[model samples]
Target: MNIDSIKNYPTGSSVKHKRKITNALEYRQESAELCDKKSVNRGYSGSFTGIGINRAAANDFKNLGNTFTDKIFRSKKFQNIVEIFENKTVVASTLVALIVAGVARPLTNIAMAGDKDKEDSMYAAAHAISSAVIGFVISSIVMAPFDKAFRKIKDDPKKYLQGLEELLDVKEIGKRKLEKSKPYKKISKVAQMIPDTLVLGVPKAMLTIALIPPILKYVFHLEKGKKKGAAPQAAQSQNLDVNNNAVKNNPAFSMIKGGVK
Candidate 1:
């Protein structure tokens, strides 16, 4: 279809169309990688704990993860995260594993080592207690910021939803023009429901827990698509090939083609 046709195509229809060629696996992988980049670039809380000096600074560093998570997911950014994770479960899973391994395990061990009755080793015990207290305090402080970010994601559900809409809308338009056979329509309808399922199903709720980084990543790709121009071109040489094949088999045109030479 020509660019104008695609542009004029109903948004609803375009979405349904694009859904066909759009590979879920690729989208998921791309989104997952993008999400990781954002998380790292934005500064996970652990990255801020430099040198461990200045208890207050360390405390801020400790909570940096929450802050970063809260900020990205609370805004349109959350959609990007969701899109990425939709395809890449490993990214999310690995992150959770790392958090528990790196943060929780050490804290629990230290806290247990600081038993109050260890008088003979009171200094070591006291050090453990002090360490545990600082860790807890820092954690609590960081959690506040993280919670704020999470609230932001909840506050704006449309960012990623809009992205999905744009994608789905374009696909619908493409399908109507390119694949209008009755059988194709049935398949298209089923395909259209996948995103709806994703948005409405268990993943929707889990987004809050996992921080919706994958969705946010997909949104980023959408933005990039817009920047690169998502609008399809009709005048491009490829269209001629498409049109030629389409009309070549017509009964009236069949003789006309073979008679040309």
Candidate 2:
């Protein structure tokens, strides 16, 4: 008989069907046995594996949450402005030096030395050393107020972050009720800028008045210039453009333009 005719035969009388069923049953039993052996070797049952994974993940999450809440949010309050300023200044200074040195490297390669081999090498070495010293000094001066500002923010993370959030109009903190609280109320605009004023003024006035030839020339490379004010001109030009556009689009600018002219 053909394969199709064999399928039409009754199962109880069919030897081929009986043999296939027996082989399928044996394969299923072998698969189950192998699975059990592998599970035992790995020391895992389905129930225990899931529970162990969930418990470990939960513990790790808990530790991370606790560290953020305890160490960052609550423990450090803004108290010592001077200490905060100094520490921040040091970090800022270090960062400034690193940035300046990176920028000065290419400049050194170009402008550092003459092409006579030995003389060029000596000049290059001297230039690098001098550049390093300049970088450190510039960094120290630049970082003072920056560090103070950092400390101010670090000391009161929420308040500082809130103010920035407000200034930027960030949506996450925009509607938070905590922004109207006592800590946020205590800081003023003038107080916020105090560190900057002091940092700049003290060094500047000292450099301008105390030094004979002006240390600012060599140290910071100070420049002098005056910018002409342009507020009125900018406002008038913007108004004129708006008027012209409104006349072009809405037919209302004609009357307004005529009156203004």
Candidate 3:
């Protein structure tokens, strides 16, 4: 703190607070020094520690690993082994494995947080590897049957599309049966629509609008047929005159009040 700020404080309280701050600063410095000493002496065979076997073993193991890795990578047998995992199925499985490993982090955050007291380095590493293996196995199992079909579809898309049309229950559009022996009669709205919408991705608004015309035509034609059949019968039921005479010459009508007056 600035001298002026310290001077602003009451003399007694300021000296007390100043001593407390000084002690805190000294404590922090001592802690930092201890940490530095430990880190610096970590690799050293200091008076308090014992043998240097671990350091020598680590160096030798590193050199041996490097030698083997270089040899394996350069060998033709290794290249062939690498090529074995280069196929579509294994590549797809590898991709799945990587994705599953990445997803495992957030997924384990809650569950592992409660179960384990603290993280262990080796356990974390093994869990990541296991996650990838689990994903690879699952993806392989799921993609097995589809692999040959996928290859076939990729080879000949037209055949695959024909098969898809059959699966989706689509029929050839506008192929009218001109030579049909029987007359054509309209079918229900559901039967009329299924083929068209099966191709159109099932848009409800468009399907409803498309159905209006066929339904309207059917209704109008049905009403016209009923009218045509009823017209002659209606005419035949009209009242008939018993005698060929005018209204004034009819005897029953002349007997009434204003019929013949």
Task: Give the best candidate by lDDT.
Answer: 2
Note the clash tally of each candidate: 45, 0, 0
Give one digit per residue, the lDDT tens place, for model 1 in 144-242. Answer: 454444334334534423344343444333324324445434534443334323433343323322332222235222221233221121111111324
TM-score-superior candidate, 2 or 3: 2
Candidate 2 lDDT at 32 equals: 52
TM-score of each candidate structure, all chains considered together = 0.19, 0.27, 0.23
- Top TM-score hit: 2
Which pairs of residues collide in candidate 3? none
List ranges where model 3 is wrong by over 4 Å.
1-119, 162-261
User: How do the residues 1-261 of candidate 2 rate in per-residue lDDT, one tens digit apiece?
Assistant: 465465344565667455544465554564455446765435332333222344456465565537755555444453343344445544344344444443454255446544533333333233333344434454466655766675565466566566465543444333233345434334433344455355653553334233412332354333111212211111112113234334532444444443442
lDDT of 3 by residue, 1-261 (tens): 565465344446666655534455554564455445756545444222333355665565565536878889878987875753433434353455455543554255335544332333223323344434434454455445545554454455455444343433344211132112122112222332333235322342233334433432453232213332211111100011112124433455555524222
What is the TM-score of candidate 1? Answer: 0.19
User: How would you order the candidates by TM-score, starting with the best?
Assistant: 2, 3, 1
- How many clashes would you count in candidate 3? 0
Off by over 4 Å in 1: 1-120, 164-261
